[model samples]
Target: MNITWNKRQLELRERFREVATDLVAVGSDARDRDASFDRELWKELAAADFWRLQVPTGAGGLGKDGWDWLAAMEGLSLGARDLGFLMSVASHSGLIRLLLTAGTPEQQHRWLPGLTSGEVAATGSTEESGGSDIRGLSTRAVPTADGGFVLNGAKAHITNAPVADVVMLAARTDTEPGAFELSLFVTRTDVDGVGSGPGEDLLGLRTSPTGPIAFRDVRVDADAVIGGVGEGLTRLYNTLAYDRILFGIIVGSSLEAQLEPLVRQLETRHAFGAPLSAQQYMQEKVVSLTMAVEGSRALAYRSFGQLEDQHDGYSLSASVTKLFASTGLVGSGLDLVQAFGHSGYESGSAVERNLRDSVAFKIAAGTDEMQKKNIFNHVRRAYRSGELAPGSRGSGT
Candidate 1:
């Protein structure tokens, strides 16, 4: 199931593995204890340039090629038991990427270096009560006579809200409800009247900060508008393909990391005078796990390649890839729990962490149902256009 890594990718994986081992040791504690993100790991990863792995050299990152960056992230995610760490790093990239794509030169110069250096953390606010309905957002930023703007609204389920150095918030700037009037604003979290509090107590990824941020007459200069008004939704949705691709990569990586270790345990341990691996029942279970992991990796890698080639069909593939990776991987996780029995259920075991973390992936990039529904809608329209191809119809047909 493993893809061939180039020399450079191999080198990068080795480097990240060192950090991954350290993270695995403490990630479970942080997740289960409902602790805030671990500052120590954040500092070490930032110092190691791990935080800036994918950022452009123009912006002070390692400038790792697209494949290398995706590969390294998948590898690290497999071993990183800390969902919070993964979420924090991802939120950081989301903010940086949007700014780099949409920010003015002055804005990039002013903020990119700090983000790459980890001098400050970043987060995004796009999803809301309407469920990613950017056009329907209740949040607004209005013109002020002083030439600045007054912002008023709130964002829910924001990752890194408690410690974000900067946040890219999307707001409507015109009367059009469905067109792209949304503007992306890069605001300092400490702006007067801008505050996040009352963190939500969650069932999983509890280690990551998830809270509501309220903006009350928050003031900002014209410079606060990223890429200016009228371009926010464009950049925000543009980033989704890459983000969803990585989300798929991580799902494959995490489940495989947990499953293989348990397979070995079953291979050697005797059960009723025979190794569990020797029993037809256990053998069947192992085969199922193998298929799940391999299936996820195959779908993810294909999607990654499409992304690398800038293929036109990638957006649709990304939906399918993300949907399968998020859901199929969990079916494989059953092996870890069943093969190891009660030991797999222990809070200290990697299997336990995998079980807890797997549930969140569907919700992370997008829900499993959402992915299917979005792709189904695309397919439905494609069918009507006679572009879905002969026999290319989806099962919902």
Candidate 2:
């Protein structure tokens, strides 16, 4: 697959880079230190149409598809240099992806405009008890005689929860013993019986607000159902697969942006009366980082291609990409910190922040263990059906 961007894509990326540097990067360090979320900066991004990059023209969005959106996000990652902020963006994009793929026309009309105009959105799937285990989720939405549902449960560790205007959430709609029956719903946070807690102080990605959302007899109209009732699992997983693809894209592009600075540091920093660049060990670090960047981008692009085509293997490809990209990012982040020595280790330094932020990639979207399980399950099914050859799953098609 040719990974080179066309001229327009390149230009879009550059434009977003400028936007990130000017609007998003400013006060990023302070925000990280204080664990703050800047609403104004979010609005700045909206004013620049950053959220519309991937929206379809028919949906009253900018007329670009997934490829163009990926290019714009690549630029944002390069220029922002703030992973916490990017994490927030990724979380918001998850909701957008769900709407674009599965939303009704009325849903899109009501939410898309606000979403593109800086009204914060969040996806509530991971519960305190369930994490990424959908079968374990307990939030319930019981149907009322009027055809509406009364939602009663809470979502924990949700991004943007503390300030979201709306949430796209999954809740149990059936309770047949030992069965998993869920439905997706969209609701305004300002409505009665909905509440959000204070943001949690985390080890990393502190700049992005992460918190809990609660629903106590929250009434939602029948129109709030997304995809359909009793049909949420498929749509949920599809959204998740898309999210994993995004993780690969974000990690790959962010690492590429760090490459030049790493090169400069190695060439200029002397140790043992010679430049660090002269040391084979140091050179190996650069080589590892370069490989990670390339590997991630290749898999990301391939999986995204499969997703756009609605290929049956998209889920498997997406899982592999997330597993590989997250591992590579955390490992390479440490390599960068080690390369810079004390300066890199200094608190509030860019490299140190990067190292901290990179840790979340392993745990968010889906954990590495979860990805492995998904990969195994998908490959086993294919192998059993005689659809895949012995070694072809790992062939990276």
CA RMSD, predictions in order: 3.6, 1.7
Question: In candidate 1, what are the lDDT values of residues 1-397, reduced to their tens digit?
Answer: 2467888887777677666767644555745575666666666777777757766777677777666876677667766766666766777777776665567777877787777665545455544575444556778888788877788898878777876777778776776555547777878887798888776777667677777778888998888888767777666655666667767666666666666676788888897898888888888877776666676667767766765566656777778877877766666666677788988888757667667666777776567777887788877888898876878654321
Expressed as tens digits, the lDDT of each residue in 1-397 for candidate 2 is: 6778999999989999899988888899999999999999999899898888778777789978889988999889888888888888888888888888888888888789999998998898989996877888889999999999999999999989998999989999986877788899999999999999989999889899999999999999999999999989888888888889988888898898889999999999998999999999999999999988999988989998888878888998999999999999998999999999999999988899999999999998889999999999987887898768765554444
TM-score, prediction 2: 0.96
User: What 10-residue stretch in candidate 1 is worst by lDDT?
Assistant: 118-127
- Give the winner by lDDT: 2
Worst 10 residues of 2 by lDDT: 388-397
